[model samples]
Target: MLKWILRRTTGKCELERICSSYPAGAERTRAVEYSLSKSKLAALKILLVSDGLNASDAANNIITLKGVDITRNEGFRPALLQCLRHISGYQKLVSEVTRLQKEKYSTAIDDHEQQLLKLWSLLKPARSRKTSKTKRVGELGFQGNDPATDFRGMGLLGLQNLVFFAENYNRSARKVLSESFHPKFGYSFAVVGINLTSLILELLCKEQLKSHFYNSVSGEPSLYHFHRVYCHVFCEFHDFWFAEEPESVMEFSRILELYKVHLLSRLTTPGMRLHSEFLAD
Candidate 1:
């Protein structure tokens, strides 16, 4: 029930407050001193200190402060409660995000599988359908006959991301698909899409997505938010790829690694979000 407040200053992470203010009757405890260095991961942990009170005692202090001094910190209780509430809500939401990401890509053509087909049909209406998965993937500009093979290391999430871009940003998706045919500059559209999926998944696993999602979404970040990000990476990377004009597709692996490093640098900046127009034009 004790909500800890932490404020980051230039070089130190210090405990700002305990329960907003000390309970009136509560014995005065000296300020907790914990110095934080430049280690980014260390900055994320909330310093939880137990001040001789049992867990239940800590929980009770939040509810009934009648005998204690409520006036000590006038505005703190509500604000601290709100912060804790947001953290709780974020934890639940992020759990769901992680769960969706971890769930292996199912090959069985379920409802989502059907959605994938619908996206393809919408994007490539002129392409004739073949009964086999390989032909359908080929029609979408994959390097190989079977699209499922590309998802081997990744999973359903990769395919889902591609379908989402097509469904949500039909014009942009088709434009990118067309760009995949850029005479000398053209690359395998489906393969690159899957590669972008892997790139995004790596970022998510590293928890680099938090700031982007927090700034972008009004509520908790969702699977759709992740897909929107994939769209950005797909489109933006295409732009980057062509601008560099690699001689052959053989440069893809090297260029992709460098691109990831470049992209992550931008994302690591404080308060950075995927621009809305990243899906446009």
Candidate 2:
């Protein structure tokens, strides 16, 4: 309530008078309130001056400050409302994505393992062989034969990200998989995909993807949008790794740091976007 009062009030005297309501800490509160009030008064003075008022006249009274605020709010009403709507939609999207991230993968669910196999098949055509599940996972470029163990931290969401990329952007996913097999610059494709999932989840938790989503989405973004971002990160990081020509996968951490810097620079731009073609770059 005090913060709101500080935001709306315009004059030092008026603010000092209002602060007296908190009788419990009258002197201390008044001092704090006085400083806040002056800062706001200074901002309103600047706002008025920008609107062509002389500083002398702008600083004279609270009435001018209220008039300036009313006019400014009225002029920017639609835009402010739009911004609020997108923020609300973003909260919903983040909540749903976070919920999905927490859903642990279960082998008891027969369809889960089948989905994993289907995703692998999409990436590389395979004959019907009676290979064990562990070997099949190994063939998909996981560090170990038991990919379920690899999914321990990120749960089903990690698998979902890998599957989404392969299923939706088959060509790009295959290209990245091929790049991951480069003799001089090889990486474990499944492991790297899982790592990228963790990276993106960190970004989501930190709210660093807000600029990208706010600029790109018209209404509400979704779990699919989150997966699309993972796909982008996977392909782009793959391209970046080869382009840098590192000595080996030993430099994976260094290369990943560079990739993160690259991503953050792009994501912070005024109108950042990530389309399928953009990911191809």
TM-score of 1: 0.69
Highest lDDT scorer: 2
Cα lDDT tens digits for candidate 1, 172-272: 99998888888888888878888888788778756676557654654435677778888889998999899889998889998898899988898876467
The clash count of every prediction, one per candidate, is: 3, 0
Q: Residues 1-281, candidate 2: write the lDDT tens digits.
A: 67557556743334333433332222322233344346656754233113233323333343354333434334232332233334444566666667767877666667677778777688777545333265766656877666777777788888889889988888888888877888898988988888899899888767678767666665445677888899888877887898999998999999999999989888766456766675542
Which 10-residue window of candidate 2 scores lowest in summed lDDT? 21-30
Candidate 1: segments with Cα more than 4 A from true spot = 1-108, 128-132
Evaluated at residue 116, the lDDT of candidate 1 is 58
lDDT of 2: 0.66
